[model samples]
Each structure stands twice: as structure tokens, then as C-alpha cells.
Target: MDKSIEKKYIPLAAYFEAATKDKITLTFSEIETIMGQPLPNASYLNVSWWKKTKPPLKHFTAWTTFGYSVTEIKLGYYVTFEKPTTDSTSSTPDQDSNDHPTYIIRSIELDDARDVIGLYQQLFAETDYMLYGQNENNVSVQSFRKLISKWKVENSGTMLIAIINGEIGGAIAIIGSTIPRKKHCISIKMGVLEKFTNYGIGTALMTEAENWARTRNITRLELSVMKSNQKAISLYQKFGFVIEGERKKSVKIGSNYMDEFYMAKVFD
Candidate 1:
């Protein structure tokens, strides 16, 4: 769960988060009691309320956060929450959310060099989503090692990778200035596999990276994101990053000139 995750649906999110059991059953009145509000009229009338896709009502995401599924819905009467059993018969340690990938978040290590390079290669191939495509990011292992080594040198930077069963789902890293004058600031970039978007890997990676930055006393963390990347911009904003300026017509891809947004997060 995200620390200080915004309570988009306040009472509902709190109720779901506090439950201790793998499965719990509740009646409509019971749920409404927990929510501290009456259920919406549409929630009771629409069959979609019981289904697990994007809830037309935002409050529905609460239980789904913990892998809760409405096993049986009696309309106005009751709802169920259960830990979905996987084909393995046991759920992966962190895979509580239904259909959510089980992933581990950790700081990158020296031994993970090959995996990191492979990730960059994969990201670079996604020409529509990244600044660097295959032709630009194709680098030798020696060169990439030097780059990561530079980030690691003198407390200047660090990387966080999201792994889902031995494969990198996404990755983010911060590069800090070692020079005394700019040591208070850092910047970063990240990408997830096209197939892995909306799985929360990007959010997890940024959460870990921000934790790392704060511990190192970084006061201002910044990044430049393509103006066209609204999803990335929204994620950055959620992490407290603010757009300070825009670089007009900065990136030229084919005949298109795309602007970039300069964003920063400042810690008090």
C-alpha cells in the first residue's frame, strides 16, 4: 500500500485497509456502516457494481486493493471479500490484488547489470513511449556499466527495479549532482514494458525511489517528461512533483516537435 496514498474514497479505502482476514462477508447495511455513508442508488441497481473492472463509482477500488472479490452478490443484501487462490494453490506473497502481478521492488545492484541493460533495450524499442529508441540507446555493456557506475559513485545516484518472477517489469533511477553546489537536487527517468502498464509497477518504482531520495537528504527531485506523456505526468504529480516550466519544441522526432515539461518535487 502507498504511504499516505490519497484517499480518493476516504471511508471506503479506510474500511478495506483495516480488514485482517483473507475473506470477510458483509451485508449492504454493514458495508454502508463501514463507509459511513449510504450506498449510491446506481451501485445497487447496476450489475457492474459487483463486477471488478473500473467501478463507475470510484469507491469500489478500495476492496480490490487487497484482492477482495465479490464472490456472491445478493444485490441489496450482501457482498463478499476473499483472497483469490491462484493456480499454484497459494498466492504469491504480495499478490493480494486480484489479477495484479506479484512484483518485488528493490534497489538495483551490481550483479543486476545484465537485467538492467536488457530492460533499457526493451524500453528503447518502444519508440512511441520513450525518448530513446533502439537506434539511440543501443550501447555496449561496458558503456552501460560505466553509466550505472557513475550514478553509484560518490552518493550521486541509485536505481530501483520492479521484478515480477525474475523479469524486470519496470525500472527508475535517480541521478544526483556530486558537486557541492548542486548536491541538494536529483533527477530521474523511468519506463515500464508496454504490456505491463496499469499494473502499478510505475507507482511502486517511484515510491521506492522517493523513499531513497529522502533518506539521502535530497531536497529537490526533478525530471523532464514529454508533453505528450499525460500518464507519466499524472504519476509525477501524484508523487508531489510540480511542473516548473516547459521546454518549447525541444524534442524533434520525425517532423514533429514535441514540448517537454520540467517538473520538480521539493521537500521541506
Candidate 2:
């Protein structure tokens, strides 16, 4: 981990509240200015309850600044889904009730970049304003390609995608260290399209990511989630993730501040 990147976990809720406050528009250019980097177009943002419920033609808002109009937002929980322990006796069914008959989950390859990008675009497009923060305009195929390229060069983790009816339905990226000193940890980012949600795609992607990490000897997984996203939080808890800390008002969405919950799962 980069010392400058801050190894501490940030709560997802805080991130949301800080990312969206009173603005009505957010764009890649604005995000780059705030994050100090060229943020991916596929990045998420959250819309506030006030904005969603009160507006006939509401615009986007920023977390800290109140005067700007954001055209898009990015919001989602960050969770670390871990591999089950070797000695654990808990049983996970090979197939869940929500698993689709024709969906295929597999490791990502270089040739799959196009599909991966497309799936990500769709996922971003379908994310709810309150759940993700931004609208569909933020998803960029070009930025997604860059991310895939970077991941390929590092090759220190796994990227898995779900295919349904011959089309990409979901994807996740798992990053870990191979160095002897840090082999026991991994980080994960999972996303599923709206149509695929509640259909076992998330569980399948998480299961595969965990298995991949275990194969590499990872014993702990860490992730962050929004405090307000009860659905994702519940899912992580069911998978054995526990709250480790909270980053108070770490993110500024618009005029309001939001907190993020840092959670972790240890598999010894």
C-alpha cells in the first residue's frame, strides 16, 4: 500500500455524503479536479434523498462545494469479500436459488476487455442515483479500457466477469500482493448490472474472487462500504465481514457530509 494513499479504511456512507450535497451536476472534469487525478468515467456518485424526492428537474451537487452543478454522480459500497477459511465447516451451496441457468462466471482475459468495458458501462448506467451518486453520463468506454490495461500489466490479482445469454452481466476486480510479506491479504471491487442484481451474480463473483485469493494464500480481505447502503452491508455481514472502523465525514457529496464504514474479514 502506498503510504500516501492512506491504508486506513474509509466509510462508504461518509464518502457518499461528502460526494453529493447540494449540486445537481457532476462530470469527469470536476471529479479529476477534486480527486487530483483523471477519474474514470465509469466512477459512481450518489444523489441525495432531498434531491431525488424534491426535484422535477434536479441537477447534480458536490459534497463540499455548494454552487456547482454536477451532471453525474458516483456512489456504491466498497466491501472486501474474503475466501472462507480452510478449516471452516460452513457450507455454501454450489448454486444459489438466484443463479441463472445460462450465466457463466469466469476469469477475465485480455481478449475480454471489450466485454468487460461494456459490462462496466452498463453497470454504471444502471446504478441508482442514491445507491451510486451519479447518472449514466459518467460511464466512459475509453477510461474502462485504460483500467483494464493497467490491471493486465500488474497482474497481481484477478478480474472475473459473468456472462449471461452470451452477454456480459457483471464483473469484479480483486487485487492482492504476491510478495512473501503481504501474501495473506487481498482487496476486491465487485459490480453487477441492475438486471443481474439479486440473481446470485454478486455471490458468484465474490465466491470466485475468494477462491482465487485463497489459492494465492490470502488470509484476510478488507473493503469499505457506505453506511447508508443497508442492502450491501447486510450482504457483507452474511459473508462474515465485520465493521472495523468509521471515517467520519470523510467524503463531501454536495452540501452535506457522509461517513464510510471500514469492514474486514479474517480467514485463518
Question: Best by TM-score, which number?
Answer: 1
Residue-level lDDT of model 2, residues 34-94, one tens digit each, is 2323323234343442134232322222221223222333453221112223444332344
Off by over 4 Å in 1: 1-98
Q: Give the whole-model CA lDDT for all candidates, comma-separated.
A: 0.73, 0.55
Backbone clashes in each candidate structure, one number apiece?
0, 56
Each model's TM-score?
0.63, 0.54
What candidate 2 gets wrong by more than 4 Å, as runs, is 1-101, 128-155, 178-180
Q: Candidate 1's residue-wise lDDT over 150-263, tens digit each?
A: 777677897777765335668887888878999989989898988788878899899888888889888999999999999999999998899999999988887988999999
